[model samples]
Structure formats: C-alpha cells, structure tokens
Target: MPSQPTLAFNRDHIHPGDRLCVAISGGADSVALLLAIHAANTAPRESLGVGLSAAHVHHGIRPDTESDADLAFVEDLCIQFDIPLHIHRADIPARASQARETLEEAARTVRYDFFRSLIASGHADTILTAHTLDDQAETVLLKLLRGAWTEGLAAIHPIIHINTPNQRPGKILRPLLQTRRTEIEAYLHALNQPWRDDSTNADTTYTRNRVRHELLPQLRTFNPSIDQTLANLAELAREEESRWQAELSRVLPQLLLPGKPVRGGGRSVSTAPGHSSLSIEIERLRPLDPALRRRILRAAARQLGSRLSFDETSRLLALCGFLTLPTVAARTGASLHLANGLRADRSPREIRLYREKQSANPE
Candidate 1:
C-alpha cells in the first residue's frame, strides 16, 4: 500500500479558498482523487476551506448504454461523497464534421470546451484532472518515440492555464500526477469504491494502450523505477523550461519593433511609448544567446497567430542567415511566411516583424 502521507502531501499542495472542480470519469484514479479530497477536507487539520464539486464530460462517442452507465456511476459517487455534480454532454460526431477533424481530436476539443463552459458559468474555478504517474510515463515515452524536443519531453504539466479563448482563464491542476495507477487502485479497493473500466482501454488499437500494455512492462523488467525516473525527468525539464521562458519574456521586447504585436496576439510591450509594429534589429539580436534568439523567433511566429513546429524553428533560423546575405533574396523570397498575418522582413540593420490585415475572421 502507498503511504497515506504521500496522498496528504499531494492534497496539501491544494490550498484553501480554491474552488476545485474534480474531473471524475468513473475510473479508479479519479475515484481515488475524489475520495482523497473528501478525506483531506474532513481531516482534523482542515486544510482546504474552499468549495469542491465533481464535473464529468460525456464524449457521446461510446454506446448510449455504456455512456449512461459511466455518467450514473459518477453521479452515484458524487452523491456518496456529498459533493455537487455537474454533468455536461457533447456530441462528438457532429462536432467532428463541423471541425473537419478526426474523432479523437474532436472529442478532446469538445471536452475542453465543455470544461471551459463550466468555468464561465461559475461552476468551478480550478479543474482538477486525474493524471497519474503511469500516464506521465506513457506520455514521456510516446514523445520520446516521436523525437520530441525539450518542451514535448516535459509532457503533461501539474498546473497550467487552459488555453481556450473567449473564456475566463482557469487553472487546470493535476494533484494526482505524482501518484501511480496501481496505488490509486489499491486506495479504491481499500475504500470498497467501485469504478467502471472503459473497454477501449484494453483494446491495443490505441497507441497509449499499446505502450501501457506492452512497452512499459518490458521496460520494468530492466528498471522497476521507470515511472519515477520519467516523472523526475519531466519535473526537471519543466523547471528548466520555466526559467528559459522567463528570460525570453524579459529580452523579447527590446528585439521587437517598438509597436509591433508580440506573438500570441498581444502587444509586445505594455508600457512602450508608442503602439506600432515590432521591428527586430537582427544585428543587435545576433550577440545574445542563441537559445534566446530561437525563443524570440518562436514568439514572433505566435504573434502572427501561427505556432512554430520543430521544423519551422529550423526554417526560421535558416531564413535569418539568408536575410544577412543579399544574394539569396533573388532566389528565395526575402520574407518568411509565418501564419496568422505575420511576416519577417530582413534588412541590413534590423529584422522587422509586422502583422498583416486580413479580411477573414481570426481564429
């Protein structure tokens, strides 16, 4: 059995006055999270003095009966715990057709949309997701298989602001991130709590299921502490990335044209004298750290409303060099095509980042 203190330590990270909406999927990990939160609130110390509620999003992808069964199970658990339950249902098929995307992507997008709606309607403040250590291990390995960069290797974060637009940004906290799947099962068994298992989880058709069933076991033969090691690596990467982001945020403004928009659709500098397009002095930027230069380029791309993929980053760097030499301009277009109405113009003294006017509605 896992130490009760470990559970308590996880719960302690959650503070009082935090309105947490627990994402309960009628799974053992979620059930354990719900019960553990209840236990912490009722403990003698009484650490959490805030509101607690259970929220479930029905994807409507599974059979009607099976989906209903999962919803009913979650409802019953919420009732047993004396917590208010908010159930939101979404039609995945309809949304997929409208969005022109795959079923998996559509379902994920719809579920998050529903979660944002809950926050918008004052249903909850923080969304507590039940992502265990096993899930983290699976994610890290999956990303590693795909040749992920530092950010991708970082995997799922313990806490991050939901990026859904037009909604009040609420926090998504993964309190169970450090806990293992087997430990959650043990906790549920000890409490005599029943959970509904999704049959699709056993289906090896899914990449995650294949990794969990086949790859992880083979790895455990060599190192039983595989999950812990991966989790540690994620934590370290997160810390490093956080520091890198902070430094980039501090240095980005000087590199940009005074009034140009920063990446991610916002002003470059809040307190700048004038609001105008951002002009990048490429010569001045060359002396700074290469990592900082890359971040600046990435930010510029985002300002144009386009996310830079790993390949895009390399292309942007190549473009920077191409701009320095006048001979290359006749062969390749002098400007780089960044998405979302943004482009970079390389001049002798500076690289100017500008946002273009578009008739179509911005996403």
Candidate 2:
C-alpha cells in the first residue's frame, strides 16, 4: 500500500481567527487537501487552526452523473469529517452562452465567483483550491500550446488576492500546490477515504482531458520525468514573474502621462454614459525597449478591463508609431477603435484610450 500523505501546509501566511474555506469537489486532490487540514485542525496546529470549512460548486452540466452523484459525495464527505459545507449551484451552459465564453471558461468563472461571494458575505476568509503539481504541469503545457507570455507560463501562484465587484478582497491559498496527483490519490487510499470521479474527466473531447491522456503520455515517452520537468519550469517561471512584475510596477508610473489618465483612470468613465479617455506620453514609451513597450501597453489595456491579443497589441503599437487614421488622414493623429467602446487616439506627444459614444445598449 502507498504510504499516507505527510500533511503539511505553508503556515507563514495563515493566521489565528482566519477561517479556511477549502474548495472541495469530492475529487481525490480536494479530498486530500480538506482531510489533511481537518486532521491538523483536530490536533490544534498553530498554523492551520480549527477554523476549517468547505465550499463546493455544483456545475450541473452532466444531468445524469454530476447533478446528483458529485454533490452527494461531497455532502457525505463533509458530514463524515464534520466540516461545514457550503454548496453553490450554477448552470455552466447558460453562463457560457450568455458570457460568450467556452464551457470550460464559464465553469471556472462561476466557481471563482462563488468563492468571492462566500468571502463577501463573511462566510470564509481564505479560499483553498487543490491544484496539484500535475495540474500545474498540464496548465503550463496548455499555455505553451497557446503561445502564452512569461506571466502565463508562470502557471499558478501559490497565493493570490481574490476580489469581486463591490466586495472586499480576500486571499486564496493553494496549500497543495507542490503535491502531485498520484500522491494525493495515495493519501486518500491510505486513509481508506472514498471520492467520486467526475464522468467528464474521461471525455477526451475536452482540451484538458486530451492533454492529460494524450499529449502528456507522448511527451513522457521522450522524457521519462516530463511531469517533474514541467513542474520545475513552472516554478522557475513563477520566480521570474515575481521579479518582472516588481520592475513593471516601478516602470509604469514613469511611463504614464501626468494629468492624462493612465494607470488607475479607466473605471469611472467606462461605466458612465459619456465618453471616457486616458493618455500616455509618446516620449516616455519611445525610450523603452520594444518588449517593455508592448508590456506597458498591455498593462494599460488590462487596467481598462480589456485584454489585447497578440495581433491587437501589435496593431495598437503600430498606431502609436506610423499608422495614420484612415478617416482622419488629413490630421496628424491616428485613431483605432478597439473592443467594447475603447477608442485609441494617438497624437505626436501622447496616446489616449477611452470609450466612444455608443447608441445601442449592451444589454
């Protein structure tokens, strides 16, 4: 039999009077995470105190198996451990269509939103997810396939601040981030713990499932320790991103134009009826390297609640340089209308970003 999991948590950030809300899906990884923490709490560990609870998201996508099976397992598991279980239900298909996102993307959004609601309502302070090293490897592979940037290659952070609309921010911690999937299952098996398997995990039609079952196996054939390789890559990336983000933060203020709405100026006007605009001095950006320049522009776009694709970022940069506005060719400036109502206008000195007037309601 496999040895029992040595339950350990990164206790530096966890505090007394802080309630931990573990996101349990009745899967082996989550089951291990909760059970380990509960065990620690039972023993009155200083780090993981007795304040342990769980939140489960029931995405009723599989009418046959998930609607009843998954939830029943989680409910039973929580009861057995005597942990408080908070259940939230979401119609992932409907959410996907309404949000114009893929079903996977919609499910993720709904899950995090549920966690945020729990925090906003004072139900839990720290939200924990059971994303293992295998999951991290799978994520890095997915991002690599999609041509991700350095930040994307970082895979997942061990902890991050979670925020929702009008809600006070809270932290989400991944205690089992370094744990492997096989190790989780072994831990559960050693405890004779039972967990429900999601029927969809076997569905190769899903990109993640395919990556796990197909691509990962092929890659392992080349490198016997592919999982470790990917995990190491992610760890290196996380450290690099930590340093890079700090530099990015320092450089952003210097590049932003004074009295021209650049860093934190995208919120108020974007929601209001009238037009909203922000500007960055061309001179400040011109001195930076191309990679840094693109990063700055991408950061600005993100603040405005719009993520730019590679093509979009490239075209936007072109607008800042030589591209002249088609309609306003007679003028010295250039204008490029982007997603939502965001309009980018560039003069010789500065580039301004704002929402244009739209007659039609977004609803």
Candidate 3:
C-alpha cells in the first residue's frame, strides 16, 4: 500500500469557524484533496476544527455520458462521506462561442464564477483547489517557453483573495501545492478509491497536454527529479517577486508624479480622451539601476491599467533615452502609442503614461 499523503494546511490560513469548500472534478488530485480534508475533519485526534464541503463543476465539453458519470461519482462520494456538495453544470462550448474564448479559458472563467457565487452567497468562506506540484512545474515550464518574466516564473500561487459583490471576502487556497500527482494517486489507491479520467487529457493539440505527456517525460530522462526542481524554482521566484513588490511600494510614491508637468505656468495635458495620467521625473529615473528603471516604468503603466510586455518595457526605457547607459541625454517630445489605448510620452523633465478612454478592455 502507498503511504498516505499528509494534509499540510497552513494554521494561519484556516480558522476553527471557517467553512472550507473543496473543488472536486472526479480527478485524482481533486479526489485526493477532498478525501484528505474529509478524513481530517472526521478524525478525533487530527480534526482541523473546520466545516468541510465539496463542489464540482461539469464542463459540458465532453460527451454527456462521460461528464454525467463523473458528476454521479462525485455525488455518490460526497453522500458516502456525509458532506454537503454543490454542483455546477456549465455549457462551456456555448460560453466559449459567445465570449470568443477558447474552451479552456471559458471553462476556467465559468468555474471561478461559480466558486465566487458560493462565497458571495455565504455557502463557503474559502475554496480549496487541488493544484499539485506537477501543475506548478508545468506552469513554470510553460512560462519559460513563452519568454516570461520573473513574476510569470512564480507560477501558481497558494492563496488568492476574492472580493465578492456582497462585500464579503473569499479566499482560494491550494493545500496540495507541494504534493506530487504520483503521491495523490497512491493515496487514492490505498483507500480503494477510483477516479474518473478525463479523456481530453490525451489530446496533444493543447500546449499543456503536450508538455505533460511528451516534454516532461523526456526531461525526466536527463533529470529524474525535474518536476521537483521546477517546483522549487517557482517557490524561489515567488519569494523574489514578493521582495520586489515591497521595494516598489516603498520607492514608487517619491518618484511617480500625477498628470503632465506644468509648462510655462500652464498644464499641457494631452487632448487624447484619457481617464488619468501619471509622470515620473527623468532626473530621478535616470540615476536608478536599469532593473529598477524597468520596474518603475512597468509600474506606472500598470497604474494606468496597462501591462507592459518585455519588448514594450524595453521600448519605453529607450524612449526615456537610457539606450545603453544612464549618461545618455533624455529625449523630449517622443510618444509611444501602446496596446489597450495606453500612451507614453517623454518630455524634457519627465515621462508620462496614460490610458486613452476607449472600449473597456479588462486586464
């Protein structure tokens, strides 16, 4: 028998009176999480001092017979454990068509919307999803392949806070973030439990499927512990990202100024329809390290509801006249029109970023 997987819930995150909901999809990872949580709740010596609930979302992408069977299995499992279960049936294909999104994107949006509804309706205080170490590894590799930055390499986060329409705060927690998929399956097998396999997982057309099925196995030939190694990289990146965020918070206020610089005793605001504008003094920006400079430029764009890609950030930095060295003279009267109706302008003394009022584009 395989050694049972331990539930490593953070004591700081879970409270005695908290209502925790486990998102189960009849897959090995999710089924193992629900089982572990339920067992902890029932064990006299190991009780977590919290209520347990289960939720399942049936994405209507697979055949009805297959999807319906998964739902049935989840329902029976919940009933056997005497746990409250919530079920959501989503027409994912129709949703994808209507929203002009891929099936994967639509399914994720629908699933999160349902989870948020549960929290807003006071059904659960926290939602737990079983994202394992393997998932983190896959995410990190995908980000690397896409030329992602440090934040992207951070991959999956363990905790996410959601603000609901009803003014209540909800949390999404991943308790199994450090556990491996092999351990999860072993735990289920030890319990004589069977999980439904999603047939779509075999489709290599999806980038993640190819990574999981082909790339990871080949990588294992070179490094047997590649999964764990990648997961550790993500953890390290997350720590670095947290540190950078703190530094940005401390330094941004002094460097960033609001609106255009006053020229000849009159403010020269852009005629472009924009909600707000932000400026940073070139004198303050030029002396900083290149890393800090890029971060500040990205931060300023973010304040205007725009995200700067790596190339975009480099372009903005070049516009500020820091091509190869800080000693380069600052440029004046240069402006860049960016995606999502955001624009950046360089003046003699400052660089300004603003969002032109256009059709709302969510980040």
TM-score of every candidate relative to the true structure: 0.81, 0.83, 0.92
Put down candidate 1 lDDT per residue, 1-363, tens digits, no spaces. 664432532664477887888888898888888888877777778547778998898878789899899999998888877999988888988888999986767977876777788787777778888999999999999888987767778998988786445667687888888888888887777766789998778978878889999999999999999989998888888888888888878877766666434458644554533222566656676677777777788776666466676665666666667223333351233666665556666655556565655556788
Total clashing pairs for each candidate: 9, 0, 0
Tens-digit lDDT track of model 3 for 1-363: 665556554445777779999999999999989988887777778578898999999899999999999999999999999999999998999999999998988999998999999999999999999999999999999999998889999999999999899879999999888898988887888788999899999999889999999999999999999999999999999999999999999999998887775647645556566578888888898789999999999888888888889878877888787774443334688788887788888887888888767776798
Q: Mind sharing the TM-score for model 2?
A: 0.83
* Candidate of highest TM-score: 3
Candidate 2 segments exceeding 4 Å error: 1-5, 44-47, 64-66, 164-169, 258-274, 320-343, 361-363
Could you tell which candidate, 1 or 2, scores higher by TM-score? 2
What lDDT would candidate 3 get against the real structure? 0.88
Per-residue lDDT tens digits for candidate 2, residues 239-351, read 98788778889987776552244366532335555555566777677777888888888887776677777766777777777334444332236677777667787766677
User: Which candidate achieves the best lDDT against the true structure?
Assistant: 3
Residue pairs in collision within model 2: none
lDDT per model vs. reference:
0.76, 0.80, 0.88
**How would you order the candidates by lDDT, starting with the best?**
3, 2, 1
Candidate 3 Cα misplacement greater than 4 A, ranges: 1-12, 264-273, 324-330, 358-363
